[model samples]
Target: MQLTQFTDLGLRVVMYLAAAAPDSSPSTKRVAEQLQLSYAHTTKVVARLSELGVVTTRRGRGGGLTITELGRGASVGWLTRQLEGDGEVVACEGDKPCPLREGCSLRGALRRAQESFYAALDSVTVADLTRAPTRTVLLDLTRPAV
Candidate 1:
């Protein structure tokens, strides 16, 4: 399954923070520059992650974002849930009534698939994502070639 841009950017921001110098907290500007993304998008992503308790932000002197312990153990499923914005799939939105309301096998199948997908993802942690070789390479210069 394809991750939404929010999830992708959120992950990048978290990984960047996780890999920064132990005593150096990166400003959003630095993170955006390093990741080659817009500052506005980086700020937005950082805010959302903070709201979700995945990352903490400190302001004023030595201010910046830091991944929380919650963030350290965060799972892909958690990110997916947050990005989903209401934990829904298909015509599950309360907006318009689905024509198939009660008897849609497709909806059931899709829901099942989504559940399975999340369940599988739940088994993984942000640490797992952080340790991923490809992502590690982008976040750290000290990463060894594989």
Candidate 2:
């Protein structure tokens, strides 16, 4: 199953914060610019993350975004599940049911595959995505432009 852009951005934001220095709190604008994402979209994503208690935001001068402990420890699977919600993977359950609904195993197979996907993700945390090489790259990319 494909992840939505929202979820993708959220994961990127978390990884970026994870790679940053402990005391360095970056602003959403900086993150947007660094990641080449739209400022408005980043703002909305950050707001949702803040509301979810994954990231905390501070206002005014010297203020920025920081990942919470929960965020740091968040499993990729859990995050995806939360972000994706219970949305169906296929159109099998829509108003117009598939003709094969009664005897088809495709839905069940897809569901199992999705669960496997998440299960694999569960083994990795957000921090796990920021290993030395990746962390170094993210740090360089996230450095504010002069």
Question: How many backbone clashes does every candidate have?
Answer: 0, 0
Give one digit per residue, the lDDT tens place, for model 2 in 1-146. Answer: 79989889888888998887889889999999888898998998899889888899999999999999999999999988887778767888668989998999998899899999999999899889988878889989767668
True-structure lDDT of candidate 1? 0.76
Number of clashes found in candidate 2: 0
User: TM-scores of all models?
Assistant: 0.80, 0.90
Candidate 2 clashes between residue pairs 3 or more apart in a chain or in different chains? none
Each candidate's root-mean-square deviation in Å? 4.0, 1.6
Cα deviation in Å at residue 86, candidate 1?
A: 2.6
lDDT of each: 0.76, 0.88
After superposition, the stretches of candidate 2 with alpha carbons farther than 4 Å from their true spots are none
